[model samples]
Target: MANAGQKNRLVAVHLDESIGRGPPDIEHERAVAIFDLIDENSFAPVGKEEGPYKLNLAIAERRLIFDIRKEDDTEVMTHILSLSPFRKIVKDYFVICESYYDAIKSGSPRRIEAIDMGRRGVHDEGSRLLQERLQGKIEVDFDTARRLFTLVCVLHWRG
Candidate 1:
């Protein structure tokens, strides 16, 4: 059952196609993250009450853009955040993910597990940073933040 707070969740999410798709694994991750995020999340732009919003995330002019709208496509607000704070974390995440993928190919179970743990740790760090950055603008739970961070990483994908 959903509480009243859950009413503020996101009903739709879209990534700008112009951003260019990543490799197969990256695409899969992006799809899964979008599915999980829409399935369950708590998202409310600060000082706003009505919701079940729609979000279109994009990276333009080196800025991370959050295009928030009402369910009916009415524009609510757009937030453009600097990407500088996330550069290091995003780079670190990609490095760890590469190691994790390689480990899954032939490495021992123990090695794979260790790499996965490190990946999750880096993911959590990114999630926390996202929450901090959106502190005064948007309110999101940790899980939502994590999922959003995943989408943010997808937007940063160059391959």
Candidate 2:
């Protein structure tokens, strides 16, 4: 658990699903598809992009990256990205996982940078509430909320 001011959440996306495996042909078709679904999901974007992404319940931007790791001799490609600066009067502040893309574009893998907050206008009320409720239960802030992408990657395991 993070203190009141400092908290770091790590969401891991590792599974034995078909997508988890590196197919003979690597492409971001699924990722692109998800990106295209974002607008309808309610996410506008901390910055801007071309797509139909599945944004979270809050209004934020959708970023993307591939989470690469090794397990049992198989290299897994998990999409990692985040939405930020979400404000919910009821929830106050919360982040959402926009999408996960496999690192398979041929050539070489790349790193995904974080979204720009200058335009995000992020604020967390629910996080504050939880902070007040616990008085130190968990540290929620820009970084914490920004961690939505990690959560999104591992969310499938919650079930």
Candidate 3:
């Protein structure tokens, strides 16, 4: 049973195909992130009370786009953010992800755990940055930001 707060969340989410989806692992991460995001999340664009919203996330002209809408597809607002602020963090995240994946295949449990911790640290940093950037535009909790950050990385993937 959902409460009033849960009713203010996203019911659907879409990622632009123009950005191109990543490889298998990346795709898996995107899927899991979206699933978790929809299952439980707190998302509300500032000053907007109508929701159970829909979101279409995309990257265009090197900018990040958040297209928010109502259940009937009525336009709410679209917030576009510069990709510049996320560049370094996103790059660092990818590097750490690659190392973590490789460690899973060849490294011991201790090494794998260590890399996973670093990966989570980088992920948290990106999430915090996202919340800061979206401040005054959208309000999302830490968990929601974390999941959205995963989707951002998915859209940012070039290969």
- State candidate 1's TM-score: 0.96
RMSD of each: 1.5, 17.2, 1.4
lDDT of each residue in 5-88, candidate 2, tens digit only: 211212222223432423222224224323332211222122223222222221113433334332232333333334232123
Cα lDDT for residue 142, candidate 3: 95
Worst 10 residues of 1 by lDDT: 1-10
How high is the lDDT of residue 129 in model 3? 96
1-159 per-residue lDDT for model 3 (tens digits): 133357678888999998676888899999999988888888989998669899999999889999999989999999999989999999999999999989988999999999999999999999999999999999999999999999999999999
Scored by lDDT, model 2 comes in at 0.28
**Order of the predicted models by TM-score, top scorer first:** 1, 3, 2
List runs of model 2 lying over 4 Å from the truth.
1-122, 146-159
lDDT of 1 by residue, 1-159 (tens): 244356789988999999788999899999999999998888989887579899999999879999999989999889999999999999999999999999999999999999999999999999999999999999999999999999999999998
Candidate 3, residue 69: the lDDT equals 96
Over 4 Å off, model 1: 1-5
Cα lDDT, model 3, residue 49: 68
lDDT ranking from best candidate downward: 1, 3, 2
